[model samples]
Target: MNTTPAFSRRSWLQRTASGFGALALHDLVQAAQTPLAVKAPRFPAKAKRVIFLFMSGGPSQPDLFDPKDYIKRMHGKTISAPINTNELRVGTDKFLALATHGEVKPRGQSGMMISDLLPHTATIADEISLLRAVHSDNNQHQPAALQFHTGVTADVRPSMGSWISYGLGAENSNLPNFITIHPDSDTRLYGASFLPAAHQGTKVVIPQGDKQSPIDYLADVSGDAKAQRARIDFTQRMNRRLLKGAEVDARMEGMIESMEIAFRMQSATPELVDISNESEATKKLYGIGEKTTDKNGRACLLARRLSEAGVRFVQVTMGGWDHHGNIRDALPKSCSETDQPCAALIKDLKSRGLLDDTLVVWSGEFGRTPWSQDLSGTSPIHKHGREHQPESFCTWMAGGGIKPGFTFGETDDFGFRPVSGKVHLHDLHATILHQLGLDHEKLTWRHLGRDFRLTDVYGNVVKEILA
Candidate 1:
């Protein structure tokens, strides 16, 4: 003490500032370590979790779920149907030739008409509620995909998964609330725009084989656990010292939370992805060993495990459905890759008693036109492919509060537009929120001096489809 210099005004001020910084750092560290605690919904929610099976490119509805008897009769004949002006226009032509493939048969006890292309899905038709007249405002891939996932065609918004995560919080303290497998490069499908950063989806590349980890970054690069712990502790402390506010900064909070989750994920994700422990019989049921269904089979099986482990929302994407040309060759291959695995996931969920509280959704962005895109007006050329049609499409739901083996809404005779029971994209979002015990009208976040909701102030829950 005698050797120490006397404190001056400048020294005193510097010491006090350092101390304040340390206090702020402490606050940040605490925020980082905070775990996701399960929260109650606005009301009693029927679904504990949701698994969205998103088919990236639009699957043709005229050739699949919505069967029009007149398409075959009017094949290669010019027909005019009321087309939605908002949808993408193929060309200047007013009328186009009609065409359809695949046999539509009544499936399951519900007598819902499904195309023969999805034989496995047909088996579980009774467990599904098919919305045959789903429509949207966009027909292009990027915009339509945006609308389907975020309830907006152009602007960045919190995705449906992010909305669910924000509403109910996370079920598992160690796992992320939202996870996307093989997510599109387009971040809008899963981004948490305007929402808390922690609500964003965690993306994992699809596992190519049993040997690889589901997430490549889950493993620690350094072999020293003690060093890792020390580093984490130091980093957290430093981060805390930089934070200052009545509340911890949101960005700092998310960064800290992500670090904690990543550390825990190092231990949890590997075991979840390793399917070698699964029985041969179960693997066969999911068509895991088969060449055609292996990729999607693994994804679906992982979805089941993640849901059982209490992940709030898991989205699995299957791409390559843009069949504008040679649709006859492309559609069946897409169906072959998904059908068995999709059906198996439903059956597995039901067997585990998870189906009652797990909501499963399958849908594409929009649908294909019933009329062919005749490029040349002179000859009947360019008749092999169909244009984008946002007027009508199909989406199916199973489990949770959905009415089983039911079909709602109807398209016109040519499957061009919804004539009855039309369900808009906003309504779909509202209904999904309703099942998760959220009031779409009230589940909103205030940003830029406005209260914005997932439904964007436009949606009525489809009560008729509820069980």
Candidate 2:
């Protein structure tokens, strides 16, 4: 057996042409060969790209997005009674404090109240419409996460991304329609159930350590231009030979096309991933080249770069939003890492006039419980800890026809349930598609002898959330 210091996944796949990254390489190797169909939107499309700020764990609506301190003080005597006389209610022995120390100030002419942790996002308040009352069915993480993306709380379904990619064929046939990046080098968020194999996200790069560039794998050496082309051409002959007998197999076709695209993307993506070309001020605005916001900021900047490059949808995730314990320690770090990049992405899109045609969503699956799990009202402060609260949550949208700086819906005095203008995960999904020029109910695929859609069977577009 060959005694080379074995292919330890990264070194093998990332370095040599035939390396450990075979599975990942295979996705690209097959991209061009697949014959996929596309369906146009029902109306004129306003946005060409979508960027999602996925807070892996949830953020507390009461403590972060929805302010209920006034209600808590007004009903100081009746704090134990039901805070909300609505369809949903939460048990309470509550002591609420905004996770960040700064004031919950209003921004833009729209008077949107944003938490201080997101200083960068605050400046772009006029560019966003804050959805303050998003509710989910699952309290647990896995199902809730799947629910947030697929719109089905329990049953299996295609994720919104797969559906989007299926409906809207990629803008740049050379690059993937859906791309995801992480700050922590984790990769557990993407899957495609029954949709076309091409609908799944192709992770061009994965997080390994210390905010490494997200485009490294996509970069190819410039030294051997002719040699590389000759090698790729020769390999294609072999791949084509294999495809000769497999005319009925779509996977072979996809693999053949993907290989060509991969070779092309190796040259294109590095430019998109590099932020150094951006102005120093722009980098600082994005928290790039900064001593502090290295992790979260990096992903945010890359999202903008990818969007502008004609990618259909880009998701940048900064986890650790669970706030289960040591939130005071954990939340701040994650928020700080993310805030500037979040704001910078919005600002960059707006300044370039792309914001009006692009959709930006910032959200967590669920939220933290309103009452402190560790601290009591009597205590001034305590160690970080928060239990799951799916009753209420926060998510915001900017551009792509969404209202700006306007807060929609409400929660109770203790900030637990939606009293008015309640928005469910399904409703939010419906609204997102509506803005993108697709009727959620109409966008469907046949599977298991039934019509399948991103919103499942229940969702009405929250018209009030529209710009």
Candidate 3:
């Protein structure tokens, strides 16, 4: 009865449904074509870009930024056990108070307490806002780092850089919105889960040799730009034909966009990664030629360069701060490798007048305990190191809308817990988003029928630290 003389009802409905699908596919194709195109912020922004200096292993706060008088007085003696009894620890059962390996004296006009191990950082103490009681939930490396980047410790979620990339897009169309230099092996630290894959951070390495490309497989093996373009055009046509037949394919669209970016990057990235054009003065400022600081110095310098070139977010990770034995001998080495490069980044940005619109953050996942921890259980007091402490740590922010020369938060006498002005990692994430003109609560993406955000239903901006 349905096929009385012509087309069946089922065939007609199928044809009409395909036309509707094509209409939806058109919108997705247009969006993928310019995914990184710059978008306006929700409001006026104090910072246009962000540079995150990630200290991978937990850096000791008592040894680097905070020193407690009570802990010093009770050095080598048993103090009240402030840690939870349920938690298992390798050493530090005796609760022997560990004094700071070096002195932390007041520096700059701000009277910010800094260690002698970071002389370069001390020089810029007046330009930074030191947060002495920053806390997080996890103690393990991977999960704590996940919390630091994704706000939740247990699940895979969009990272802060990826969220920022989604929010503001990119100021430079030729480059990615998010780039991480020398990141950890874990991809989750910079992943863009549940978001467009285009927002995922592009990993880069500072080339050790003259001919090595900073990005893997960057060199065009075809040897002809015209031939490459022709091949890409053909491939894109095939991809679009495949996309037209699908209901929805965000990953397919992302791959299309990524391939285009990779083609464009073949021309744009080489000049940015080459540091030879930089002046001798600039090179020396970052300690580029020195053997002790060469690796990190190159990474930091590259970060500044990329930031200046309009990359929305850049991260540089420096590790080796996990000290469980012979801390006095080890902590200084870690400091030496990173101190100058980090401080130089601030100064270089300031000199270029970029600091006013750039937010620079320096922090680790957590901090070390004030009590001695000897994993070997046979080391002396001076040789013993500290255990992981997620209760309190130090994080510093510079430029953007942050108040320079200001110090916020305080910890208990034992340096085990926050006593005042506690700023959780969630709060830090909120404040950073706020400075960039994104309300942490409002910048969200819908997934699985619920709105997800970087702060995840928590976080309050610490107004006192704002300029």
lDDT of 1: 0.80
**Which scores greater on TM-score, model 1 or model 3?**
3
Structural similarity to truth (TM-score) of each candidate: 0.89, 0.80, 0.93
| lDDT against the true structure, each candidate | 0.80, 0.68, 0.87
For candidate 1, the 10 contiguous residues with the lowest summed lDDT are 1-10
385-459: candidate 3 lDDT, tens digit per residue: 989888999999999989999999999999989999999999999999899988788777655646688999899
Query: How many residue pairs clash per model?
Result: 2, 19, 0
Ranking by lDDT: 3, 1, 2
Superposed by TM-score, candidate 1 places the C-alpha of residue 360 at a distance from the truth, in angstroms, of: 0.5
Residue 110's C-alpha lDDT in candidate 1?
A: 81
Which of the numbered candidates is closest to the native, going by highest lDDT?
3
Error in Å for residue 401 of model 1: 1.3
Determine the C-alpha RMSD for candidate 2 after optimal superposition of all C-alphas: 9.4
Q: What's model 2's TM-score?
A: 0.80
